[model samples]
Target chain A: MKPVFTRPRSLADVSTHYCPGCTHGIVHRLIAEAIDELDIAERTIGVAPVGCAVLAYNYFNVDFQEAAHGRAPAVATGIKRALPDRVVFTYQGDGDLASIGTAEIVHAANRGEAITVIYVNNAIYGMTGGQMAPTTLAGQKTTTSPFGRDVEVCGYPIRMAELLATLVAPRYIARVAVNSPAHIQQAKRAIKRAFEVQVNDHGFALVEVLSTCPTNWGLPPKKALAWLEENMIPYYPLGEFKVPKEAE
Target chain B: MAKGKVVINEDRCKGCELCTTVCPHKILALDPKKINKLGYHPVTLTDPEECIGCALCARMCPDCVIEVYRE
Candidate 1:
């Protein structure tokens, strides 16, 4: 019998530090598979973020650079500018991308940086033990907001995919979830499209993935996925918010 | 009418049941009596003949521990 499913070549043959039930592992596989399928693993440079996926550099079998918290875009910009022939992508979580890195991400998108960003939004801060993040739902309960997030005081959750799509420089921007098999397939397609934008020499491209944080969300691996489907999907609508006309 | 199998890297499994939840066949279960290197129960196929090699479990596994094979 032939093996139908195995680990991708672009992924390192080792274990990841992600918590059990965390979809970060799935997202990593998706990105690695894209790189392998495109045959760009040799030239791809990933900028690692300072969150749950901080050690992503160790998982992917490509050249990697470490960026400060919320500075992946800036770091990626430098890398792309210095080495235009290389493929550059940033892996960032909601806390790293939406909060401290907000300004950096917006400016990078506005400046039309030629890079791809794999944005993982698990609502709460998983690496930091369930703290409220910028993308956390208004009524969600986190360690910092034990009483549930109050929109009046904390402000509403930011819809990043919609917010970034308003910019004209972005060649592609999409939001997808990976709770179920169907969504996982869709998420992989979106990731491939994000990379294609860069391969075609297009401007900024970002794929926002709504991931599950079972440990931080206080749910079992299975229930957390269900919670994401039922609660997170409604608020963070999924789709390609922006796509270049020719590619659309 | 198809036969399949699931090969698990028991040492790598973190005992996350994401794959078990998505198995339409309901043939995957964490071995209660067996513990892997990680101290967590590793998921295993309860009945090899029941596997359809759908690969949904492999897709859902965060650790990439499950590999599906078919004839």
Candidate 2:
């Protein structure tokens, strides 16, 4: 017998803290697999941000730096600058990146920092008790938006990938979902390409992953993925918004 | 048809039931009779031979406890 799906070496041998069917774990696996496949696990440095995935440092088998909420791009920038030989990446959620870390990420990409970012956009703030986040749907319900998100007051959900794509320094920017097997496969490819952009020293790269939050969404794991496909995917379409010419 | 089976790392499993939802053959289910050290019902294969080794369960597992093998 042969095993096709084994744990990636880049992933540590421990359980994660993400909620069931949260899709964070799936994103973690994809990142870990990318690191292992690129054979750069030892030289990789990961910046963990403040959010549901704040403890990501405990899961990846690499040197990790904890960044302030929304400051992961800044932290990763310093790390990549000090050690240009090492591959540096940041794992951040929507609340940490799209909202608070907006300035940091914008500057980092604007400067073309040689780093990679794995952005998990679950729409709502998962750790802070499901508040309406910048990426939250127009009419999505959350603890802060029990009446559902009012676009008139809250404005439309910000599309960070598209926003970042507008910058010239970004070498690669893609948005993908892990709701189904086919999409998950595409996400892995996008994630791998983002890391490759950094490894090749092309420029800054980011992969925005559309994740699920079953506990916060008040939906079962299966239904959460379905809801994401029906409600979230329309607002945040999945595809590569930017690509490095070398990669093409 | 391919022959396949799963290996569950009980202690690593949080019994999230995410993996069970992705299995097309419906061979996976939480163990009601046994509990892991974490006091959670770990997922187990009900009919090992029914596994088509899709690996979707492994993909959806947050705990990374499930390993898929096929022959």
DockQ winner: 1
lDDT of 1: 0.93
Error of 1 at B25 (Å): 1.1
lDDT of 1 by residue, A1-248 (tens): 78999899999999988888899999999999999989999999999999999999999999999999999999999999999988999999999999999999999999999999999999989888999998999889999999999999999988888999999899899999999899999999999989988988657999999999998899998999999989999999999999978866
Q: Judged by DockQ cut-offs, is candidate 2 incorrect, acceptable, medium or high?
A: medium
Query: What's the DockQ of model 2?
Result: 0.68
Span of 10 residues, lowest total lDDT, candidate 2 chain B: B12-21
- TM-score for candidate 2 (chain B): 0.91
Which ten-residue region of model 2 chain A has the weakest summed lDDT? A14-23
User: Model 1 in CAPRI terms: which quality?
Assistant: high
Error of 1 at A81 (Å): 0.2
Q: Please state the error at residue A173 of candidate 2 in Å.
A: 0.4
Which is the leading candidate under lDDT? 1
